[model samples]
Target: MKLVLEGIGHAFLGRAVFEKLDFSLAPGEVVALLGPSGCGKTTLLQIAAGLIDPLRGRIRRSYRRHAVVFQESRLLPWVTTRDNISYGLRVTGGKSTSHRQIAERRAREVGLHPNDLDKYPVELSGGMRQRAAVARALAVDPDVIFFDEPFTAVDVGLKRVLQDLVIAAAAREHFSALFVTHDLSEAVRVADRLVVLSEGGTGFVTNRRIDGRPGDRSDRAIFDMMEAWSRDPAFSELFDGERKGLP
Candidate 1:
């Protein structure tokens, strides 16, 4: 299965952010979408999620189910982390092998302890909150998972952990991903393919067939890719070593 983006285009509030944005994700492929701020990265992700309508172009996919992890945890403030993780499963009536008690099992796979199941969002750190969000999305057993900067506020160590978790899941579950992030380092560590978002969110291939090196995120090749893209007149001014938001 693959998600094909043919000439995908969009504008925000009368301002064009991108045009003719084309890309695709084959089954089990984790593709990272990287671009500078104001390039419409988030807008592209949202369009993929059906949260926003594209002003033009066509998106074709045959996936039966999908899920997303927004940059912010976006959890229900009132629920415990465990409840939050299992909430989507309950809502969708999801069932795996044992159908009856899969929610608890799913949370355990993502490293959430049974005890912390009762802790609410107010009690967890930013990283832990995002972890719960990840577990929730995975529990849905989606064919496509959209991760919109899942590691932003997370510390480096935890970012590695989360990246590994995502990679392992893709390997085991054969799920495809459209991961959006501004961190070039992250794109190298987790993606099988990379699409750089140029000015106004237009995407152009930067790196493909990455075959992620979970440990060598800082490799020279990764930096070289960033340097080459940054030197290109189209994207040179985008990064500028500046931080960008999920939007």
Candidate 2:
């Protein structure tokens, strides 16, 4: 396993978010963490990414390095797209010339135009900013990437485009990922396996493998799989009214 969480549990103030959660990510695998609002999906991702320490748990990360792509672009407004993409490299002590070279390469890989590299976040469209954010995460050459509902803000067409970029990048780079999202279709599209959290953040609902590889599934097949899951009793809570409100 690239990462493992054993008997994990956490709380805020006096309230518990989750208890005794066990999760793992294998090398080059993408696992979608799906749950309803306020079920602590983001909280679990943060713990897995080492952004926060769980109150009671042991986390073992065997990878060399990791990065995160947030729901918002979270770009530095003061910096140009090029600089934003290269920021991680610079922080890790890369030289100026090499940083520029690598940043441009990653930018192009994420479909950002050469001209757009010089523009600040405010000048680019929402989808373009997200592209830059993804480019930034990829620039670090991480062995693991944590995605926190990264595509929820974009329109449907652009969302698919960005999701494809993620699928292609994961296939080519062979990086493991823990993707947190409420959208079942997006999870079905990007992950090799699915793990669901129960409402109220008590524990897991289910953990199961998808039928096919991430990029190999056809649109019709994806729709059919989702339809089947929707009718499944295990997935009933996902579509219930309880999934709404809070978080």
Model 2 lDDT tens row, 1-247? 9999999999999799999999999999999998877889999999999899999999999999999999999999999999999998976895899999999999999999999999999999999999999999999999999999999999999999999999999999999999998889999999999999997766988999998999999999999999999988777777773445545
Error of 2 at 127 (Å): 0.5
Off by over 4 Å in 2: 241-247
lDDT of 1 by residue, 37-116 (tens): 76788888999888898999998988888899988999898987767777776656545434324556766777777776
The C-alpha TM-scores of every prediction are: 0.86, 0.97
Task: Please name the candidate that would achieve the greatest lDDT relative to the true structure.
Answer: 2
What lDDT, from 0 to 1, does candidate 2 have?
0.93
- Give the poorly placed runs of model 1, Cα more than 4 Å off: 94-100, 205-207, 211-235, 241-247
lDDT of candidates 1 onward, in order = 0.78, 0.93
Error of 2 at 164 (Å): 0.3
